[model samples]
Target: MTNDIIPVILWCVPRSVSTATERAFMGKEGCRCWHEPLGDPFYFSSKRQSLRYSEEECKASGNWDKDIVDVMQTLLDPEANNVGTDKKGPVKYVFVKDMAQYIIPRQTLEKIHKGQGSQCYRTDGETCGTSRCTGVDSEGEIIENPTVIPTALMRRFKHTFLVRTPTKAVPSYYKCCQDKMAGFEFFDGAEAGFEELRILYKWISNPRSTFNTDKEDGPGAVSFPGKAQKQPLPPPLIDASVLLANPASTIKHICDQTGIPFDPAMLSWDAKPQAEFAKWGAYHQGAENSTGFKCEDDGAAKTNGEEAKIAKLPQEVRNTIERNMEPYEWLVKRQTTFA
Candidate 1:
């Protein structure tokens, strides 16, 4: 039944205006959107990799014990309730907005490269029975260079990316962390999220990759029992600035690419706080309050005191952004342009 549903994931960096992008999709008929579903498992699950939050903080936040595989299953579930909705029904399309960092934390990836097996968790939070459980194939052989979420599971979605310039994104993220109401003592620079996005993008775009080994019939040509399937078109990349500069055309372009019908009504919605976003504290306040897409006075102008702000950022934040700029620009060059 789930196979009949179209699943789309918008992998994004923090402060990339992705939540608002999710809101636009919420206005689309028959589309159900999930806001950062993988984050719960990544930050709070039993097999969690981050220690940034203490035990008390973890307990205060609900969904502190979700498994990665279980969350992935939920995303693929057609009848799963839409964000902020209790009623269940069939959905033709499922849209997920999530950070790439949540899918595979940099530290976890490093551990895998060092030959330390990260335990694979079942839906029940129990570890799988495999001896070295980075990821196991259908036949239970260990997958090399495993992502925190298995590659096989990741291949199921039509992936896309939402990127923001490090100059703007880095400062915005730091400001969020500095907000007392946002519930963080200090920012974790590792969560800047560009490196992981690049890695996933490359893996998805590579034709010779093992992720395309499925012999099932689909959009790509059919493969024999042991043959590789044809490579999929590379995922679309959307820059936050470009999306904001012209929301209607940009979103239409996105719809055209993803096989969704373009509707002008997707440009606006009732402004209110969403129950799905409440659990994250103030991180989503901007999205929660937005009535529609609006470019800031200097947003498209590109002269918005951005340089001044970047200069004031802490040295660590500056360094993180500097390290991420290469990948960020690489993605920017390939972003889908509507203008």
Candidate 2:
């Protein structure tokens, strides 16, 4: 919220090279990026008792409702040193990379069931005036709504959705599951990343967004949370293929779309993970192994891009790929293309 620092949120699905994107932002001088601030909370609030991570590990991750609230507050804290400078002076943005799935609608239901009520849905005074999290879906259907995260909180930042073809991202995500010792049975074909991305995009597109205001609770009052009153432009959509195809152009394009100055440093970074990411590096090895985007190849080395290899994949995995394609294509078509 500072005059000098713009808060940016990069929301992507698992194995989208999102960590590398975060590293790109981290490369910018004076910019500090968080790996996944909402991860622990999301894990703690999850109802999946038979998860791969131990219950103790999940508990150790922390409570979702409390953690998200804390992060929202911190990101908006005026006194914090969220702004840093390069040769151009003050830093223009603070980036946070998070998986779209980290925020859960099911967790909201779990909270309500526990009598925690809707307090978990509140954001800063400017972004959220009410506790109700209702919105119209892409289909124009209106119904009772429980946000995956507070809508008010989401409106506070410049958001970008990083997407990859499911034929690639799904199998890679499965590999991560295996690496973590989570059995293959955990993979769900129905939990496509685009489904949640669309939900977030639609909510963000709505003009009736809650935001900070002087009146905490009043019958009727106008509030301002973001840059202006009208619905802001749709968040920037960057395809992973586009990013890898030409990292410099893609990163600059993203900076332009988000209103932040492009920093050449964003094109590359040290291969090592940041100290804050030490606890989560095991899951981020792809990013850790890469110093920058791969241009010599199509960025498919990690992914089995061959038709033969894809055909050899388990039938269930192929089914998941088939199911995810519709949404993935829906998003990819909207992405900003570089030449």
Best model number under lDDT: 1
Q: After aligning candidate 1 to the native by TM-score, how far in Å is the CA of 144 from where it should be?
A: 6.7
- What does candidate 2's lDDT look like per residue over 103-202, in tens digits? 6454332322232122223222333223333444456632222354444445556777888888778888766655663223355443445566655554
lDDT of 1: 0.70
Pull out the clashing pairs in model 1: none
- Best candidate (score: TM-score): 1
Residue range 1-339, candidate 1, lDDT tens digits: 434666778889998989999999986887888888888877776667565666677777776778777787677755464445543456777789998767664454443323222222112223333322344455533334236655555666777888998888888888888894366747766677786676666556554444555434344322111122123366678899888888998888777777678899999988898877876788898898999987855644456577777778888788778878998998888776555
- Model 1, C-alpha of 301: deviation from truth (Å): 8.3
